[model samples]
Every structure is written in C-alpha cells, then in structure tokens.
Target chain A: MIKISDLRKGIPISNDPYGDLAKIFSMRKDELIKILNDMVNKGQIIKFRALLDHEKLGYRVSALIAMNMDDENIEKVINLAHITHFYVREKNEKFPYSYFAMAHFFNEDELKSFSKKLDEMHINYEILRTVKNLKNDVK
Target chain B: MDEVDRKILIYIQNEFPIDDRPYLKIAKDLGLDEFEVMNRIINLYNLGYIKKIIPKLSKSYIEKYERALVAIKANEKDIVKVSEFINSFENITHNYLRDHHYNIWFTISGKNFEEILKQIKIITEKLEIDDYIILRSVKSLKLDTEFEVKK
Candidate 1:
C-alpha cells in the first residue's frame, strides 16, 4: 500500500510516486473525497502539516523529554513551553515516566534550565538527546 | 540564512506552488529570479536546515491503523538488539534511544491495540526483556508543525 506518509514527502509529486499510488487501491474519486472528509471531522486526520529543520533555523537545542506523572496529572505536567509532539504514555513499574514531548530551544542553557525546573518540582525526568536523526522517515 | 533566503523559506511552509513552473511562480511572488529561489532552497537542503520538501500528508489517511508511543527498558547487552528489533516492524514510524531506564522508545503502528500488544508479546518473548510501556496520543496537542525563521 502507498502509505499517506509517502504522499507528503517533499518530492515534486511527479510521475513515479503518483503512479505508485494509482496502483494501490481502486476507489472512485467522489467516494475518496467523502471518506477523507468524514475522517477529517472525527480528528482521525490532521489535514496538513510541515516538518521543518528547526536546528538549521536556529532552534538548535532540541530533545525528547519524558516526564513521570500519574494518569490524572499527565496533562498538568505537559503544560510547559515550546513542547510539541506531546503524548501521554502508559506508566510501568520499572519506569514511572508517562508523558513524552519534543522541546525546541535556541540555547542549550534554556533547555537545561527547563529540565532543572522540572527537577526542582520533584518531577523525575529523562532527556533523550537526539545524537543523530538516523531514520527520520515516518513509515 | 539572509533576508532573501528567509523569504523563500516562509513561502513554502505547509505548501508549495503546484504548477509546471512552480519555482517560477515562487520567484515571481518573492520578487527574485526563479534560479535564485531554487539556489537558496538547494543551499538550505544541503546545510541540513531543510530535511526535504514533503507533501505533508494528513494523519487521518492512516486512521485505520493503531498507533502508540512505546518505551522498552532493555539492558546494556540487549540495547542494540532491541533497537534493531523495533526498527524491523513494518509500521513502526519513529524510533529513538532516550537516556532513561526505558532507553528504547519507538512508535508502533498496527491494525488495533491488540496487534500492537501482539508485536510486543512476540518481541519480548524473543528478546527475553519484559519491561516496557505503551503510550497512545490521547489528545494531539500538536502535529504537522512548522517553524518560523527570524528576520
């Protein structure tokens, strides 16, 4: 199947990719529009988005942070600044962390400061610094 | 990145002109030559500021598939094996190694919650590491995001 992720890839939308999509499913044009519209209404589909190189644009200090919080308090923990790609994950016995986020900052000190505040609040956390984006492709 | 380049980047966020001469249209709007706009975009890509210009598909397109954020706690010996194992899954989109006890974090895409659990069961049994957590996006605060370039 030609996945939707493959469609939004910044390629020229030329022959090969489009041709590949055509090969996949057989559906009427009008039906696809209606089906896509229905999905969009239910929050099933975020219609459009852009993935930027924030580091190149000067938001260099970026990392994924996981915060330990109980089920009821996950939302409160994530009410921080500049946090995108946020999620409330399940908590386990071994690792109590239940929230995840991507933080982008222009300065490393700012990022350190944010982490320090979380620590001061007695919120256990882990900073998963991205060493290198090995495979960024969204399958 | 200079003013001209910044202008170019700003124009293409979430979309680009769809035409035979798309760059030409972009150049016209920015009051720069087509080649200049193309050159700056190319430069940005080479500098790693621009990953690639992708279509930015809708998340709903795969609404049928189940997805979750999974954190697997593997020991030092099994870290590499676990990472490789997570990468092997078909719909596992983004994978990462965090500096936490649950070092291996990856997203799993499946038909439903049961399918994800099945993948986890099979892998944990094979690798002999049973500790992990699964997090679903209960509410997507943000997705398909774009960054603003300072002038």
Candidate 2:
C-alpha cells in the first residue's frame, strides 16, 4: 500500500537541487498530480511553501523570547515581523513565562528595540539568542 | 531576492494553487506570465532561498504525532557530535545550538512518548549528560513563518 509516509521518504528536498518528483517516485506525472490535488483539497497538505532562510535574507539576531503578559493582547503580539513560532507555555509555576516566541532582526539594536517596545507596553520578557541551528527541517 | 521574487515567496508561502498548472493561477494572481513565475520559482528553489514545497498536515489531522522541545549541555568540542546524534533521529525536527548553559536545543515529534523516549535514551546515555528539560507545548498561538515582501 502506498502510505503517506512513503511520500515523505523521497529525496530530501533541501539536499536535492532538482525536483524530479515523478522520476524519483517512479510514477507518472498525471498520477502524482492527482494525489497532490487530493491531498491539498483534503487539507492534508497545508500549502506548497517557500520557507525563506531569515539569516540568508540578511537578517540577524534571533531569539527565543519568553513573555509574561495579560491574555487580551495575545492577538496583537503574534502579528509582528520575523515571529516564526508563538506559543503559550504549559501552565507551570517554575516556567517563569507564559508565552514563548521566536523572533529575528537585522541587528541587536532592532532586537532590543522590539523587546523594549514590549516592555514599554507592560510586557515583561526574557530571551536566549541562538548560537547555531543544527537542524531546522519542517516536519 | 528582489521585489518580484519576494512577492512570489510571500504569495506562495501561505497558499498553493492545486490545479493542473498551479503556476498559471499564481501568474494570474501576481500579474505575471505563467513561464515567468515558474522560472522564478525554479531559480529560487535552485538557490537555497526556498526549501521544498511539501504537504503540511495539521496537528489535529496528523494526530499520530506528538512534539516537544529539549535542551542539552555540551562543551565546545563535543557539541558537533551531540547535534549529529540528535538529528540522526527521524523525528527530531528542529535542533539548534543556543546561547545558554543548556546550549544545545532541539524539537522532536513522534507517534507518542514511548517513541520519543527511545530516541532520548540514545542522547542521554551516549552523551553522558543528563541536564535537560522537555517542554511540551500547551497551545500554539501562532504557527507560521511568513516572510515580508510587500512591506
């Protein structure tokens, strides 16, 4: 049986320069398109994304920022630039912060200004800079 | 990575056309010829500006998998080995060497805790380091990484 996992086992897309999905999978183009169309319509495939590398795009100063703020402004917070992942931490007394977000900026000044803006808005937060990315594969 | 390219990136990142010629629709929407958009996407893919265009399954839809973040400690030299070992696991999605005592960080997903545990054991035992934290996500307020082209 052709399972969904089989679709993922093809050439690691990042490593492969040429996308020969039909040739690699040993399937005809029409059949592959049908499967893809069905997947998209069913919401199994969210979208065909072009995930830009923020660092490669000349943006620097990335951080894992933890913020403690009231619940009402959560909608306002997530719409900012370079914020890739935003989540509310599992309720734990020792966790220190309730919300976690990942942000990237062109420089330290920009990063600090964003943080300062959050602070001025009465949002208390802390951050940890990213030293290196080992693996950033989208799953 | 100019204006047209960024527009293409931003447009395609959120939604993909699922027709016989998907690029044709994108061209129509972006006010460009079909061939131009296709060529530009091919170029972007060739350049490492754009990663794979894959199926992004929803959490509720792909409920078989569960995810968590972990932090590990390592000195300068052994960090390479640590990252290699952690990323070797198919389920380990995002791994980073961060600026902290628990410097090495990564996210992993699996069918369940049992599957994740088997991979974790390899790291804990092989590295001979036990300082780590498993932070499970309670709720994802926002789970997108869209770039700004229009801005």
Among all candidates shown, the one with the greatest TM-score: 2
Score each candidate by Cα lDDT: 0.64, 0.71
Q: Which residue pairs clash in candidate 1?
A: A8-B54, A8-B55, A8-B56, A9-B54, A9-B55, A10-B53, A10-B54, A45-B60, A89-B135
* Per-residue C-alpha lDDT of model 1 across residues A26-130, encoded as one tens digit per residue: 644344445544545655444432355776688867688877754655566556666767765556555556677787778889898888777767777778876
Best by lDDT: 2
Which regions of candidate 1 are displaced past 4 Å? A1-3, A8-50, A68-81, A113-128, A131-139, B57-59, B62-64, B75-81, B148-151
Error of 1 at A38 (Å): 14
Chain A TM-scores of all predicted models: 0.62, 0.80
Candidate 2: share of reference interface contacts reproduced = 0.64
Question: Any runs in candidate 2 off by more than 4 Å, and if so which?
Answer: A1-19, A91-95, A136-139, B62-64
Tell the DockQ for candidate 2. Answer: 0.49
